[model samples]
Target: MCAVSDDVQISVRKMDMRYRHETLLKDLNFDVHTQDVFVIMGESGCGKSTLLRHMIGLTRPRHGDIFYQGKSFWHCGPEQREEMMQHFGVMYQNGALWTSMTLVENVALPLKQFTTLTRRKIKHAVEFKLALVGLDGYGDYYPAELSGGMRKRAAIARAMALDPKILFFDEPSAGLDPINSKRLDELLLELRDNFGATIVVVTHELDSIFSIANNSIFIEPKVKSIIGRGNPKKLLETTDNPKIIEFLTRGERYE
Candidate 1:
């Protein structure tokens, strides 16, 4: 575990999420601590990404509210909600970089939209962000020209453009080779260890769940709720839930 304090950065309280009038998750509750790499792990079709969408304000819950710093997100006014969202940075599964824009331009977009810095200052900031993600001289390259891993890193650089306090990633390792996935995991750890970022990642990758996560929640699709929570390794050793064990062990017998 990461020895985090009792500070809760994001809290999901009694949350119920649905798709097409079918409940996907009901009465969901969880807390993400400050500076912790919190992972949301589950099988496919478990609403892992759906819960993420709610956390990032892309969608509202059917029954409850999400709180950031103890302030209610769904109940807040638009201006306040926008202000709260400014503190979050999200990298979606597909990298989502604009194909027409160079890496510099893509990374610069957020700074340009959010800050009042001069063009010279924004250029400096953009370079610094790209370098932070190991894309130092590739700023001028288009997204299509880069490798899959590089494109994902570039997306991260853009996410960090405004230096958000909390970073949210949905299926970050979805399309990478094992080496690239490991490298990305290392980068995520670096961000948490060096920069004091509170990261929330939604992924089903077992390697990543064990390697990078200090805290986690496993969403059970059939039950439509979380069946397990806490450190992933500890959960593996202590949890008696067969479904959770099967998931953690890739459907193999744990004993």
Candidate 2:
């Protein structure tokens, strides 16, 4: 078993990101603690995904630094970076599965690549992960054969294949019906409770946010920065920022 320490799983200190002179994240500072369901919410184009990329060491910050488990990822050697990334599981919004592979094949690929587990062990592992995401019998199905929700579930299964300590979800509920979306939320909560994995979700869905977020950070569109951080319900009730209030109230006017 891995030891848990007070060090941040993902930490950004005064980080800034820019593309073609446009600032995406400006002076962002936050720490994602161990075993937390930390949601990042914002209007579209507020750099929520950009912030996530920085957290995972995908995009290097133009200024400041990102640390994973108390070590600066930007300064780490390639081998060290790979080791750190192995501790994380990322589920992209698009489900990012290979079209040529069956669901189980997709889920098992990570185990094959990263571990020396035999084919039998990989198959068993894949089956277990698929069942966890409610896709027990669909492992043989192709990506095109599954529904959007099922594909998402399969993608989630693949993400959990390596049993990562932290799971980063990019818009996990996108393009799903209300029922499927709600089911995904329940699965996310179950992941935290069952596996003790820290979850960081990037989303704009009110239902998902209210249902799953224990703590969250709201990025302001205009400022391109986080303006609120705390329990979602408490931040909504006490915040006077019109955008924050508007977001919490589901875009309904409060007068």
Candidate 3:
């Protein structure tokens, strides 16, 4: 409901995530609208990252389907799914950059693998992606040469190399100090507002959950379902559920 537009970008219907016979999540249904900063937040063991994996085609749901523009992702052919995945930019919990590569080489990997662009053009594209993430002149730097935040930004540049429509992030702020986390949050909003990119983030950082997410779902591991949904600030103001309130308040008494 916090979405500015009613246009649904991704839909998860009757989804169940399981590892073998043990169900991790059940009957999960949600809609991520176009341009939404949709946060998936919960306690550590909940299925937040698992749900992200399901959405991105890295893992298949044990039951039900995930749809993009009404086409079933899980039920699609491998070729079709690979095509869909090309347009999705994912930044994992770790920056995932190869220490042996420079930023330019790292960013150019996707373009080289997926497109027919010449080496010169690929370099040009890589520079643009780096600039987009505020890393304009760091192209020659290796992952070890940068700070943690800068490394994360470098990873983001690589993810954006293909010009993805929907960007997915896993705990983007996990290792940052408060100031760096806030800067990362600002960059995410800039991506959403300036480029109209739809974003899905898996994070439990309340500061970020409130700062960036326009819409969200809080999954509870014990219940194996979503226990909270909507804007984090609004949920803090309006919800009476103890677990949710406790979560939003960091277990302090909410007036």
Give TM per candidate. Answer: 0.92, 0.92, 0.90
Across residues 1-255, which tens digit of lDDT does each residue of candidate 3 receive?
122224788988889999668899999999998899999989887878888889999888988898886777888799999988888999977789989999999999999999999999999899888886678999999999998878888888887788788999988888777876787788788888888889999998988999899999989888999998999999888888888999888998846
The 0-to-1 C-alpha lDDT of every candidate, in the order given, reads 0.89, 0.85, 0.87
Q: Which ranges in model 2 have alpha carbons more than 4 Å from their true place?
A: 1-7
Residue 232 of model 2 has an lDDT of 89
Clashes of each: 0, 0, 0
Worst 10 residues of 2 by lDDT: 1-10
Looking at model 3, which ten-residue stretch has the lowest summed lDDT?
Answer: 1-10
lDDT of 1 by residue, 1-255 (tens): 112235888888889999888999999988998888999999887898888999999898998888887888999798999999999999987899999999999999988898999999999999998887778999999999999888988888888888798999988887778886887899888888887889999998899999999999999989889999999999999999998999899988846
Q: Of models 1 and 3, which has the larger TM-score?
A: 1
- What candidate 1 gets wrong by more than 4 Å, as runs, is 1-6
Writing each residue's lDDT as its tens digit, candidate 2 over 83-140 gives 8999899998889899999999999888999999999999999999898778889989
lDDT of 3 at 198: 93
